[model samples]
Target: MDSSGAGAGAASPNPKCCVSLSAFYNNTIVPCPNCSCNCKGLPGAKCHSEENAGSMLQMPHDPLQEPEDLVRCTDHMCPIRVHWHVKQNYKAYWRVKITVTNLNMVRNYSDWSLVVQHPNLQSVQQIFSFNFQPLKIHGFLNDTGMFWGVRYYNEILMQSGVDGNVQTEMLLSKNTSLFTLHEGWAFPRKISFNGDHCVMPPPDDYPRVPNSSTASKLSLPVLVFISLLPIIIFVGPSHFLDYL
Candidate 1:
């Protein structure tokens, strides 16, 4: 009876058919473990996971490199104004406030960055956003210069249509001996955004440092007293008393 049952031909599972239980549960087809094709799933499909889903759409980017022809300032009549002020002045160091204003009446700017070159810029001690609140900024400064690539957190996006204008401010400390301050304001050697120089008005409008020595000069009374001393010595005491 056993021999007759064997001859009846009950089907056996195929050796080529191999599918994981997880794959079956997830409704995905995984390649057989022994297969040479190494096909994990459908060509365009993937097994979804929380970690993988978060990274699937990521693209590589270099923060230092800017996109080509991102700014067309030459073609547009819009202008970017750069103004700087000396907030504090000392013998060795000074604090400066830099203002960048987008004077573009019609266009909007996004992903903007600024580069300022100064011989005496030592470091950036603090930064402020458009709201006049302290903001964490990313940049570096050395003896030669300083640069900042403004991103979403601190980027200046001037929506000319809505706000009418946009501006950003930065406060920095510099080595005073490296730069010359006329009046109380000092100008940077160059100010640029995305490799294009911004338009700067004449320094005549900036604040000036008062000449401290001018006030220390001899007054008319003091000068007269000094002159009288020499004359008093040349003349006799009786003559000086007579003149008095």
Candidate 2:
């Protein structure tokens, strides 16, 4: 084997428009950037309109057909997208929903996989409509997970159309002492599709759990205590203790 290596060409960076993360939290949905991909400029690029997308999806996919990028027409112009949503919060648990959409009209994936990272992924108690395995990267405190569809069900992600998406929801037990919803802490830190890293929205754009909401929670209890103070004083300590 020759020790001298061939000349390496200039590095070609990853495209910013191939895929994006569309996140929804609380009452806000963070959308992908407009016109992120120059699909129109690409030679032989094709896009299906919203009205035709549903009809095209009804057709059976051809397994032996040649691969091509057939994306649906959207503001982002990407061939695929990933969505993360914070569905609900409970006293001891929180819920999340992840949806993966294939905008390509001609591409269907088999044995697809997703890689996710977040602080509380190890605390996930249950997952619906998907399979999950923890990735033990940091000793016993695994913060990463690999997810895939249930076989014979959503294992094959259909091409772009009305039902060209797969979805799953999960519940994670919260450690009250360490859990927080603020600063996008409730959302996934990173996600990848089929080994390709997805483009994430900037931190400043993430849906925030504002301080006003937390203050509102505290206000109610303080109001109740204030209202009862006069009664306690009027009844005296002895009467108040007996009433309790």
RMSD of each: 27.9, 8.2
Candidate 2 per-residue lDDT, tens place, 1-244, comes to: 1111101223225422233333334466787656555456566556778677676656765555545566777777766687888888889999988888877776677777778889999899999999999999778779999998898899777776677899999999999998887877876777777666666777787887655654566678797777778988998766876765
Question: So what's the TM-score on candidate 1?
Answer: 0.45
Which window of ten consecutive residues has the lowest lDDT sum in model 2? 1-10
The segments of candidate 1 whose C-alpha lies over 4 angstroms from its true place after superposition are 1-77, 128-154, 161-185, 200-212, 215-218, 229-243
Every model's TM-score: 0.45, 0.72
Compared with the true structure, what per-residue lDDT tens digits does model 1 show for residues 8-66? 12322321111111111123222113321113353522223323433432444344443
lDDT, residue 181, candidate 2: 79
In model 2, state the lDDT of residue 76. 72
Q: What is the C-alpha lDDT of each candidate?
A: 0.40, 0.72
